[model samples]
Target: MSSDVLVCQGISKSYGEGEQKEQVLSRVDLTFQKGQASVLIGPSGSGKTTLLSILGCLLAPSEGELIINSEAVNFKDKSSLTEVRRLKLGFIFQHAQLLPFLTIKENLVVFARNTGMQADDIEQRIQLLIERLQLVAMAPKFPSQLSGGQRQRVAIARALLHRPSIVLADEPTAALDWHNGQTVVELLLDQARVEQAVLVVVTHDVRMLPLFDRILAIENGIVQVKQNVK
Candidate 1:
């Protein structure tokens, strides 16, 4: 297996077709090392999210190869792609996307089941997630019962519940105010390190850039590492 947790080689994405096609990413190559936090920053419509989607196996690049968790990706095979996404990658979007009708614990169970986790000691796992994410009191509560930050925390816990090897977050703090954003960023950084999973976050906010191991700048379909703090 490769040492890198996620690899993107000559990746490119285009919308439309032929002369009408617009290229969003142009031959981008990116590799994320295990247990490292990589921050991707770019202006709006700069293809930051597009690249992230490719890296997370949520979208297939028009050209190039993406390897996640040392597995060579076969995008044409839906089952393989689905398996990789379920078993290896965890995603946290701008919204929590928690099931509104289910309780916090139930939401986690849904995630675990999709990830193919064994049923043994499921409650123990849920309790640990609750404690780790400081969501203990909200475990029995529904998504509607929590604040924005708390909901996002539950989302983060759900992402980590499967013990995925990598986490891809898209503007996780975009919806929160400054203080809440900072708190969520700190929690993500802390948990990613503790879980030893490769963490990639795409956002325009510069406030949290210093906390990342490296900052990847994306502009007009071009990507370059602006700083390597590692």
Candidate 2:
């Protein structure tokens, strides 16, 4: 089996039309292997989020292909795109985005159930993630009741619960303190490694850059590999 889990080929994204058209990404090419954690950094309007969105299948690139697990994504096929997201991708946003009415565990369960996990397996997975994320006590608490860091921890658990092949995070630590941010990133990296998932994080924090296996920097609609460890 191939180690490559996520591959972007000649990916390009633009907005508007003709003279009004604005290019956001230019023939960007990236390959993320299993168990690889990459941090993407760039200026505010450097198209970092645009590229991430394409990778997450939330948006279609104007010109290029996105392949996950060797299958080319069909942007025109809504059902297929939905399936790809549900079966192959996990996402963590800047905010925890947990359902306010549901308890932490319930939040995780909803997604697991949506992905067609069996009741027994869902229960087991939830238990394992709760313990691993040190979110045992918070599991029964509602999202509104938990601290920011605690909520983010639950978010991590929620994202990893289904064992998706690709994990994408967008400024996950943006709303937390440095200590909490560091802790959350560490936990995310550790869990992704355990799952052998391709982890891609978009951040403006240069401080957290070194924690990832590779650092991808975007400038003027182009992506440049700033660093790669091992």
Candidate 3:
């Protein structure tokens, strides 16, 4: 089987119409293979988030195709797009975004159940991730009761609980201290590799760039490969 898990072909995104149209992305072609972790860096308004949104299936590109696991995405079909996102993609954000009322384990369980994971399977996955992330004690605590780093660790576990083929993180360490940020990124990379998932992270931290297998930079609506370790 092909190692390629996520691909963007001639992808472009624009806003408004005709004379008022503003292009955000231009022919953004990218292919992410299994077990590869890539970090995207760019100036503010350089379309980094726009491209990530398209990759996450949260937004449709004006022109071009997004292929996930060799299947072309039908952006026009809302149900199909929903299915794609639910089944093939995992996401982490700047904030942990955990439910205030639910405990850590509850949060993970809810998401896994939504993805159709069986009760026994969900329990096993949750146990494994909780231990791997060192979130065992926090599992019974609510999000508000945990530290920022602890919360983000739970977020990582939540994202990987379903074992999605593609994992996308948007400035996941933006709110943490240097030590915590580094730890979070390291854990994310290690877990993604263990899951053999395609990992894509958007960040502005130059220090974190070298941790990824590949570095992609965006400028003036274009994406260029900055570094590749593999």
Candidate 4:
């Protein structure tokens, strides 16, 4: 069986048209397989987040095919894309974005529920994830009650709560200090490995570059594989 989770062929992204057109990505070819941790590094306005968004199904690429878990994304069909985003993909943003009114466990459960997982199954998975994330004691607490690290952990737990096949993180550790940042990255790596999911992270923290399996440096919308420091 093929282990590939994501494949991008001749991927190009642009805005506007003709005279006003702006090309952000050009002929970017890439492949990400299960259990691989890939990091994207780039300068500001280098299309890192744009490419991530396109990969996450939040945005449509102007040209080329994006295959996720072997299913081609039909940009013309919003519902098809929504189904892919909901059932197969997971996203972790720089902010935890947990609802203030919901408890830590509740925040995670809501997603699983929305994804149509059964009640008992949801509970079972959330319990295990929160335990692994060490958020067991903090389950009943709200987002504001937890520290930055704790909140990011909860965010991670939430993202993985539904057991998606591919995980995309956008600057996940950008806000924390080194210690907390590394801790978050380690936890993400460990859980991603356990789940056998493809993990792609975007980061500006050069100090954490050595942790990823591969490094993709982007500048002016072009992606170049720098090195596999792992």
Q: For model 4, state the Cα shift of residue 21 in Å.
A: 1.6
Off by over 4 Å in 2: none
Candidate 3 runs further than 4 Å off: none
Residue by residue across 1-230, what tens digits does model 2's lDDT show?
Answer: 98999999999999999999999999999999999999999999999999999999999999999999999999999899999999899999999899999998889999999999999999999999999999998888999999888988898888888899999999999999999999999999999999999999998887888899999899989999866654
Give the per-residue lDDT digits (tens) of candidate 4, residues 128-218: 9989999999999999999988999998888788888889999989889999999999999899999988989999999888988989899
Clashing pairs for model 4 are: none
Encode model 3's per-residue lDDT on 1-230: one tens digit a residue. Answer: 99999989999999999899999999988999999999999999999999999999999999999999999999999999999888889999999899999999899999999999999999999999999999998888999999889998998998898999999999999999999999999999999999999999999899998899989999989999876654
Candidate 2 is scored at a TM of 0.98
Clashes of 1: 0
Q: What is the C-alpha lDDT of each candidate?
A: 0.88, 0.93, 0.93, 0.90
RMSD of each: 1.4, 0.9, 1.0, 1.0
Better of 3 and 4 by TM-score: 3
How much is 93 displaced in model 1, in angstroms? 0.9
Where is the poorest 10-residue window by lDDT in model 4?
A: 221-230
Cα-lDDT of candidate 1: 0.88
Name model 4 segments beyond 4 Å from true: none
